[model samples]
Target: TRMRPLMRGGAQERGRRAGTENVPGIAGFGAAALEARSNLEARTAHFLQLRSRLEDGLDEIENVKIIAREAPRAPHISSFIVKGVRAESLALNLDLKGFAVGTGSACASGALEPSHVLGAMGYSASEAKSALRVSFGVQNTEAEVDEFLAALREMTNRNGTLSGRSTSHFTL
Candidate 1:
């Protein structure tokens, strides 16, 4: 059996990964994971507090629905729907303002596919496409969420279209 190994090459990662093992990348990931684990309790508390504040701010906006409002959610992530606007458009508009957001399953990012999870949970295709995912890290602050809400509100005003695309139209 010439091809005993998966790739017929040296076991870069003990026959696990085929490509060369990225030491730096792996190290960085491990460091971040350890840091997150070490601060899990405090970070969870902070994220929960921030999520409440953000949800409250979102409530002040019109035509928006907080997904799973009655369901459980991870403290670090939020998914919502901005009625009458495409999630991609809204996400892009916010990203241009120096904010990062996810429009669908993070693993399928840039694929323009509606989330299977949302679809399976009974959201129509159109509604699923309008879903947006926002994640928070320990470095974030409540004030930042307030600012983000302001930008999002302006971007998806009652007109159902993004406001002026210029930096002047949004305050990050």
Candidate 2:
């Protein structure tokens, strides 16, 4: 493979390595940046409201624990652990039920070890491994958050043990 300069000139980009410009990617990135900057305040408020609702519902579940509940955190993301359930099994079950959830940081997806971030937060290895993350976006609504809350409550209650048998079919 050969490196092609994006601009065929005497010196392009400080005469360093270069390649063909990704026009489409650059355009999409620009569009996204513009959109994000357009209504930033409104988007932040919406995400905060949704996260509040989610946290309230999660609080009613006896076995669920929200990480960093007292610390200031991002309004769009929530991390929690179900006392006796494995995060991977719960995530898969939710996926089958049409909800996408993440078990760990994107950079460490599929890794067997627990998250280092969670460990730094003073969580035990098992608790860190059980962490599940949910994110709220501009496209989400209160109804969707409620539905997700209900589904999570049901799944956690249904299993109710460390047996890790929550992989069974979960309807709704």
Q: Which of the numbered candidates is closest to the native, going by highest TM-score?
A: 2
User: For model 1, how does the per-residue alpha-carbon lDDT over 15-130 read when each residue is reduced to its tens digit?
Assistant: 64577767999999999999979988998999888888888888888877888877887888777887777888887778877787877555556666777878777887888777
**Over the full model, what C-alpha lDDT does candidate 1 score relative to the true structure?**
0.76
Regions of candidate 1 where Cα sits further than 4 Å from its true position: 1-35, 165-172
lDDT of 1 at 108: 53
TM-score of each: 0.74, 0.78
Q: Clashes in model 1: which pairs?
A: none
For model 2, where is the 10-residue window of minimal lDDT? 163-172
lDDT of each: 0.76, 0.77
lDDT of 1 at 17: 50
lDDT per residue, candidate 2, 95-166, as tens digits?
A: 866888787554456789988888877888888778788887788999988888877776775445433355
How many residue pairs collide in each prediction?
0, 0
TM accuracy, model 1? 0.74
